[model samples]
Target: MLALDFINIGNGDCILIREMEGTRQKFALMVDFGHDCLVRDDHPGELDPRSQRIYAGDFLRELGVTHLDVALATHFHRDHIGGLGRVLDAVTIDRFYTTYLPPENAPELDPFHPDNNLPKAARSALLCLQIFTEALQSHPGRIKQFELVPGTETISLQLTPDLKMDILCGEPALYRRQKEIYDAAFNGERNGYELVRWAKSMNVCSLRQRLYYHGKEIVLGGDAYAHVWETVNLTPCDILKVPHHASFDSTS
Candidate 1:
């Protein structure tokens, strides 16, 4: 048996998957866990320091999950990765999956670039990304532990013979395109103004994946845009977790 639980973590995307081999045991996989609005000035600010630490932590503990077989952060945007630090602190994750093109693959960034003034949302997202990256880097062994969820790859869960996950899209081509454009812009060959917009376009870089059990299919599109979908190899699916929260850009 397989089950999916869509968590209510305010404005963020969080889904829990359970694959059971028999009535006795099951495995867990969590996808995304942060809110873009939560880290902003608009945050309710109701939770004290103690409560803050235990907010998402308690929720996971209540699920009776001692360890996660896999944890996936589709992109680097805060709404997807913000609460990850807390999640990491609360659970033992065997493997963490993601698709953000690292610094080496992309052009160097100037946080205060005159032509690329980042707004409040981008700044907050960057902060959350830094925190999560720093945490992973501090532990030398963990730096190599992260696995990049490749595009068009299918992964099978060991717990259930009939369960498999397919990555329908994760554009290495887009990463390469971004790298080329940003590299040229920084080198004075193109408009630097476009860099800021490119930075935020990482949403299109999301690694959309699908779960298959028997014949049922569920497509999990994480903030991916229409352009990304157009270039991807896809088939009809039973259910789709709408992309970009069903925003116009994703649907169109």
Candidate 2:
């Protein structure tokens, strides 16, 4: 049996996929479990912040899922990875997937990194990266395997003779191009004052994936926005998990 649960983790995403074998073996994969109060600030009637995390944790436990075959972090944004640290602490993940990996020379202590000359936004991003790296260091055996995938890459899992899951996406060429331009401008000191604006614009670099199961296809369109989609190749799918929680600016 194959099942997919679109976990309610507030404005973020926490999708759980299950593949059952015969009667004893089972496999599970999780894609982005995050929660942020700001995303729900406009909806005062939504679930309480504390309850949201608790509920998500309880759901996983109820499923008898002690370990995950794969756990993916689409991006480093707080809203997309906020409560994930807690989840990681609670569960055993065999394989991990993410867009960025800690640098070989990652500092042992928190310090200004990835170029102090960069704007505050970029600096903050580097800090987040540092934190994730530290977490992996703290738990050496927790993650048996780790894969740093980019836009065009794909990860395939064979569940049964008939059911399969394919994680697919196009390469992130446009984002890299934009970064080159940003770097040139910043290096030339031509737009030093607009550093934050240019740095913040990199948020659309989120990863997108297409999950194929049986004969149906579902697209997990991370937080990728309109401009990001324009640079990638996306085919039609049976189901589409609306991008950026269906934010107006996320899609055309």
The whole-model C-alpha lDDT of candidate 2 against the native structure comes to 0.64
Task: Report, for all candidates in order, the number of backbone clashes.
Answer: 0, 2
Over 4 Å off in model 1, which ranges? 21-25, 36-56, 101-125, 135-144, 150-159, 177-195
Off by over 4 Å in 2: 21-25, 36-56, 108-124, 150-160, 170-202, 230-233
The C-alpha lDDT values of all candidates are: 0.64, 0.64
**TM-score, one value per model:** 0.73, 0.72
Per-residue lDDT tens digits of candidate 2, residues 1-252?
A: 667788766667778877777654377878877663434634667554476344345567776667888888877665666656556666788888876565444455332543446656655544444456566666667778888675555667664565566655444673454445444433333333444554465456666667667788878888878776777576789988888888899899
Q: How far does residue 195 in candidate 1 sit from its true spot (Å)?
A: 5.0
| Per-residue accuracy of model 1 over 1-252 as CA lDDT, tens digit each | 887877656666877788866643367788887653443446566544443332344468777666778788877666677666666656777778865434432333444455656565444444554545544544343322567655445454443577778655555676565556534543544343454566676787787778888899889999988887887567899988999888999976
* Residue pairs with backbone atoms closer than 3 Å in model 2 (clashes): 151-170, 152-170
